[model samples]
Target chain A: MTINASKDLYAAVPDEQGRFGPYGGKFVSETLMAALAELEVVYSNLSTDKHFQQELDHDLQHYVGRPSPLYEAKRWSDSIGGARIYLKREDLNHTGAHKVNNTVGQALLAKHMGKKRVIAETGAGQHGVATATIAARLGLDCVVFMGETDIQRQALNVYRMKLLGAEVVSVTSGSRTLKDAMNEAMRDWVTNVDNTFYIIGTVAGPHPYPMLVRDFQCVIGREARAQSLAQTGRLPDALVACVGGGSNAIGLFHPFLHDESVAMYGVEAGGHGISTNQHAAPLTAGTPGVLHGNRTYLMQDSDGQIMDTHSISAGLDYPGVGPEHSWLKDIGRVNYVVANDDEALRAFHKLTKIEGIMPALETSHALAYAETLAATMTPEQTIIVNLSGRGDKDILTVAEIDGIVV
Target chain B: MSRIAGRFQQLAAQRRTALIPYIVAGDPSQDATVPLMHRMVESGADIIELGVPFSDPMSEGPVIQQAHERALANGMCLSRVLELVQEFRKSDDTTPLLLMGYANPVMYMGYKAFADAASAAGLDALITVDIPPEEVDDINAQLQRVDMDNIFLVAPTTPEERISRIAAGASGFIYYVSLKGVTGAGHLDMEEVTQRLAAIRRHSQLPLAVGFGIKDADSARAVAAVADGVVVGSALVNAMAQTLADGGNSGQAIEAVASLLGEIRQGIDSAAS
Candidate 1:
């Protein structure tokens, strides 16, 4: 059973303390309590404050170029020959991804809160670049915590962030990946709470974070809804987006939660396969536990220590999904699925060749699933896939696999 | 009176500040834990803050983090930590022992079960690093039933209004992290510590045990002059680690740890005296 369509998504969730059923809670250090408490107040006041909304609207229109097009993938749709496919091209955003949406909102929030610096944790580097872009625009000091592994793999994005004038800290702890970077970022936030604002890149972390990030990114779903209705004369039959800490997916699916006729899909990274114990699909195969500030689905061993997750896409390498996603999954509001590394690679090639859009490896997971789902539906049906980011940063990664010199 | 209260009373009567040494439960070796604890007491440690190793410790810096990795590498679990406490309790019941770590392991054992087991093991107090006052009152209620004190940490970032609320659920003592950074960090601001502890004193009468950033005997003495207790973690843990690469025996490791504790103990006593 998915979340009830009758209940308002905003009214039903995260109460005052940032909880979604039993999922989201302030599972953070005592040092961060005051900062989070103050943030809650600031976010609440500014969310309704007309001036803040105007500034955000101005940035969305002119700065990041919002209202990203709903493009019909005619060639790609015809090849599948089942459903008409449309793409909400988030890849066209300022940082070439949907990640900039949340960053812009949080950077604005930081400005409102009187914080002079912003810090973020990133895995795939899209969120880092996004945060760096906003911090540069707002003239706030920026620091991005990236795992040692990710810094090595995503060197181009690292250079881009540095070129944007953001200091990048390499996290060397715990498997040296996204989760470790998250821990380091939290440590930095806890230590530097007075003058710095931690802009979490995902729709996860502690309470207000899941709610706030979802609220900010919901701009995606809001625009897509109006555009889809205008262009297609009705709502799309299905909505699909890849889940990695689930910001982009939740951004697309949240507004459509009340749409009973629309089927929602959240595609997660399946590194090799689920049975191989090398994937990051926590909602699909994980137990509920606390990590990175919220209690949600996690990939952990029996003794409760978090397990290392494997995924070709660094963005989806985390072992936990957003708590709201976990809640929605439990309530059956969203169908959580997976696209393996091979399938995602195939979709990357297919989308690039067919649609002339080189999608991020993270977004390729959505494209992979949408292809299969489209094959099952009749041509009368319609599907909207959130092409979360452009794949330029992943060119070297893809080229390495193809054994070609770039 | 509780063991923690009695110790504080005894220390107050002696006009001396308490010296609390912290260690990861099974760091050097599981079998060596009880002996190292006993050795610490002999070296003038007034209390023990035994770490229950967690996979993720968000607030801890590199030193304690590495200590946890070594302990978990030896397959140390929460039950093993309780067993060590029980073993330590068999020989010594007077010294108060506080189990310090994050909340996940305790959450894994149910609150009631964890409280019961800890009380049975003679753990006098517990400090869950992640829990704040609002989220922990329920667990504190259960812990209180077992006569176990839930010690809360009042960090430098902790707001003044929140301190009284944090102190309300507090027992044993309130740990005041001396710096804004994590465990093992240097840069102890003696003036800042004096000012913050004075502010904390206005909100809390709970004996304040200052920790974090107290690296040496001099810093411990400086902090002890202001607060009721001084906790030295990373420096002592770092001492034990300095010998690990050379394949040093537990005896050598314990000697290094106890030696540092002795100096800090002397530092506090000399300051108070």
Candidate 2:
């Protein structure tokens, strides 16, 4: 289980047992173990298969609109007064976010496996919308379990999912939020394993899922790597991304891990602040324990009861991060930082005014940190911020927060 | 003798199937638990599976979910659940007690601490619904140090190779979930049960218990015809839920559940004849 720090980190990871240095492993029930094993074999075979790769590539190009452009944010960089900044335009994806990348990949897997239905648990409803979109395209029956609280906050996306022909199930469980939605989804998945595929939106579930999600999402890093060189004539000096379940962050960081020159910063949701016990910063404020499926840093109390996590953005409001992110954080390969609610709000406004790009509240956490970080770097250097999603889903939430009802 | 083995031996000697009923430890109230256990045994229960209320019981349906909510509302936790087992042992030492729940609470307490405390508290076995054989080996090793039994679940989708793998570490009898869905779901098809059990018997020498869909006396009899034991859960808890909805308390739950168990016992015995 020793990680060879000298070698390529990604290759060493998720070894035969799916351990990302004691963080990732299969911790599901017996009923799910077989399913995971089945998926592992299928994914392993298909990941290397040339036709499968080609089909995935074709879909990413024609269906999902991949190679999401890396745009240079000249105005925002000048306003910040330091390093030049570039935006990885994942917000431009068909569903207005990077979540569709992984969903398209998983829904394809479901089709390959002959599964007739797809189910997912959503937080801000972005993942739900993305999953519903893909399922609709593939003509698969889709069901989304969204927390009642989140469903209320993001009604527009909920309606979008209904338009896509997916059933939206309101979860009224503990906390009435993302974690409970996940619990209900797991329950549903365990029940309907025969003909259904549970398309986990993040890189944080049991074995093969975290690995598979990271693999599917690695396209971001892959495309960004090539795009950075083609645009800037070099790998960007630094990479910044928001970490909820850490899928988009990992997607954008994986290809750059072996490049010793690039610095990576993962900004977590510091709801109020880490010191105030109201943040969703597990890697920054919490300890390692098991939750969902894998062993990862979790925002849990001393008794192992998962604590309530908070953030203005529901997408970044999870108690646990991806297990690979935990391994990366421990190895010091990535600097894990935080941005509180106010800072993200300020960044949201700054991005909209300067760059004319309305960023999702979740992605604004990364932008907020990048604003201060760019101030310290040289002008010759560059940074790429993953604009993981658009702000369309959060307008009403923001409007209500600002006391403007409409 | 381990309580599970001893009870199975007694049941085999009498040529009767085990009628094991499940109940949440503090469903109505903690004070009502030990008495409820006694009443269930008085109505021909061979063993008792006491549910530890978890914040999320993913394998459960509406009935058991409400039972967990009620039990937690009554201040039931892992510590209190162990204390309830200690109380149950004071009067009844013969019936095997299994602490069935999810892995989080048990893991939160630390496996060694919880295992030692639960074994010392007279708990004979456990069935963590979420702890499969892969993730359970560490805890199984801990429980084995104390001679405790860690029961595993086998579903219809379980492959034979996996059944062998799960069977290796399993100490107590294997619980075969009768259907693909959660507890309190589906109607029992004895034909499917017979076929799945036949597949499971190839890899497991331990006694087999069928749960999940065994609802009434007729279904219980149908399951008991093939299984070594029939576990009835939501049916008993639903009885209590109905009684409480009717403005009744633990006294009424005791009567309703005992009556239900008595009928199931008769059905099981009659099926044997």
What are the RMSDs of all candidates, in order? 1.7, 1.8
Report the lDDT of model 1 for residue A373: 98
Model 2 stretches with alpha carbons more than 4 Å out: A1-4
C-alpha local distance difference test of each model: 0.91, 0.90
- TM-score for candidate 2, please give it: 0.96
In candidate 2, what fraction of native interface contacts survive?
0.62
Per-prediction fnat: 0.53, 0.62
Clashes of 2: 0
- Note the chain A TM-score of all models in turn: 0.99, 0.98
Clashing pairs in 1: A1-A331, A1-A332, A2-A331, A2-A332, A2-A333
- What's the TM-score of each model vs. the native? 0.97, 0.96
lDDT of 2 by residue, B207-254 (tens): 899999888989988988889999999999999889989999779979
TM for candidate 1 is: 0.97
